[model samples]
Target: MTESSPTVWGVGTTRTLRAHWALAEAGVAYETKPIQSRSGETQTDGYAALNPKQKIPFLEHGDVKISESYAIVDYVFEVFGGDRVYRPATSAERAASNEWCSTILMELDAHTLYVMRRHGDLKDLYGAAPAAIDAAKEYFTKLADAMVMKLPAGPTCLLSEKISVADILLMSCLDWAVLYQVPVPEAYGDYRKRMSERPAYQQAFDFNFEVLGVTHKDLPR
Candidate 1:
């Protein structure tokens, strides 16, 4: 729990939110070197030494320096070895959680981010023709519907009923989704609201924006 032990370098509104959420939930003390997208900090040789990929959300624990969001999550789970609330116990439940997290990151998050990039900086960012906004919107619509259908069946729902890593990952993605003005259906909208109401989610939201000094207001209306 010492400040010098586990240091994290992460970016604003990135999957580093996942690491922050897990740290907060686990009650672990960590020092965060938050990077900005436009600041060029991520590309510096100093940072590149820690993370060859030159990406934010890289973690350094003494001799260990790790990159990748999921890898950091796993490391947090192991090092803290507490907060079973964020991590499911049973193998079946853990498997399901992993599946949902992977599905969201691998499929839904990319699709949503593509739509965001296309809408926000398509020509300048990639210098290529982008997909139609309407088509992207429709794609998000289908993704939302499918995600909503995956909501838990029993008393323990993904957002409202229990605190799971899936909830954290989903909350992180939704943070960007909201800022990017990604069109989520009513069901997913409600789900996002439910997650946002939680204390952990609130902390993550405040920390991400505060450290980054960016305004969601800049997002498209």
Candidate 2:
């Protein structure tokens, strides 16, 4: 790989998938480091030197270094905007897009799905809380249903007809929710099916998840 080619670190998680997916959508050539979370790899001296926070989905393109998955996606589109993917063009558009991204990341991802992951799947490490998990699941359903209702009746994405980072972010969270067996709106199901068929998303899914011996079809829809 050329030194200037983008490098993405981490795999096997929805967050990491977002980074790879954005690069694929942009049709950018890049390299992969394939680190896993909680696997002691992120704690290594080399990785820690690259990112003190030790988060996956980190991107390094020349002098640009971004740790968060959302920021990485945003950076890619800024450098390589395309017809295949949508990045906000105006100040008002960017603000609205940011609103959708922030809500999805917080409401559907960190605030809901990860709550179940923490207290349910990783209970041995994070401790179990049946009540919290149940509450979180209910919260996810309510918010998702409400969000679906707000969508302009018939478009494949969250922000607009063209797929954007907001759509990718929301799609990743929705996929995570489905894997966790959280109830989601029927509109969400339709949107997920359509978005999953995107060639870029398909490529990213394989690159981001094939290392783990699973595919989207292997998981529940």
Candidate 3:
């Protein structure tokens, strides 16, 4: 990799997909260093030195290292997007993008979808909790209802006419929800279908599967 090339340190997961989608949308030339959690690659001392938290999808740009998917996506947009379609233009647009992304990450992805995964598909790794799973399902249903209300009248984008980080973030999370069998609101079905057709999203999906040695069918759909 060149000195100017950014590197992403994970693959397969939606969190990593967020980084890839943002970079692709911004037309950033980047490299991937696939670290498989299933193989314990993230637990090693080498990876730990890069991120003490030992999380997947950490980003390295020059000497700067950033962990967490949302932060990485925002950093990519600010540093590389500029006037690109991935970065919002006006203050209202920026706020809308932030609101959508934050809501998806916190209210849906982290609290609900992930909780469902922990208890459902990833029970072996995280230990299953029936009550937690049930509660998460209930909470996720409510959140999905809210998402349905916020969804723009779109064949174009989420916050605006142009695609932004909010769309990327929401699409990634919704894909996760689909894979994990979490209930997605019917209103979002069309939005998901539309965003899934994006070239950037397709490229990111291909890269993710190629690096992780998994196919679409291999995921929990």
Candidate 4:
């Protein structure tokens, strides 16, 4: 690895998983700086200096500091993914990948999955809202139904024959759904199963868990 290898800071959450998985899929050598959110590590003045927003999954590559999980995935792909299997091969494929990522983040992750987490597992922290949880469940069920139709006959990528950034995004979101007990359509359930079996995915998972000293069971459920 060169001096250009990036450093990622975050625990074993879904957001951080995306960054780790993307870097692994891109075949990029990177380092981890695991920030313990529960212990207020991200709120420190030092970490705050790197990210004013003080979010987890912050990334440092060369002189660039990137926040947000999807942006980190994009950065890894753009900077290091030349001829990599995880990138889109054409303009149309790229557009499709972005579209899938956007829809999944906005509709499924932000609207449905996080809402469930806020109400269910993190209820003590965020204050549970029964009505909001119900509404989110309804919305997610519809979204999952639509995703089943949208997903290709996959044991493959979301948009093409090869994996792309979109697959990383969607797989992380689906993992969140399962962790948080969201009902997933059969198609996407199979999709998640297949993607999770990838060597890159396992590598990322192992790194996050080993560094953070947590397992899947340790996550909020």
TM-score of each: 0.81, 0.93, 0.89, 0.89
lDDT per residue for candidate 2 within 32-140, as digits (tens), equals 9999987899999999999999879799989888999989988887787567667677998889888788889888898999899999978999999999999999999
The residue ranges of model 2 lying beyond 4 angstroms of the native Cα positions read none
Could you report the Cα RMSD, in angstroms, for every candidate shown? Answer: 3.4, 1.6, 2.4, 2.8
lDDT of 3 by residue, 105-159 (tens): 8988889888887778789989989999889878887887876767887576887
Per-residue lDDT tens digits for candidate 4, residues 50-167, read 9999878899988998999989988888888776655665898777777788888999889998898888878999998999999998898798787676688646777766677888
Q: What number of clashing residue pairs does each candidate have, in the order they appear? A: 0, 0, 0, 0
Enumerate residue pairs that collide in model 4.
Answer: none
lDDT of each: 0.68, 0.85, 0.81, 0.80
lDDT of 3: 0.81
Model 1 local distance difference test score: 0.68
Which regions of candidate 3 are displaced past 4 Å?
Answer: 89-91, 211-221
Off by over 4 Å in 1: 1-4, 89-91, 132-134, 154-161, 211-221
What ranking emerges by lDDT with the best candidate at the front?
A: 2, 3, 4, 1
Name the better of 1 and 4 by TM-score: 4
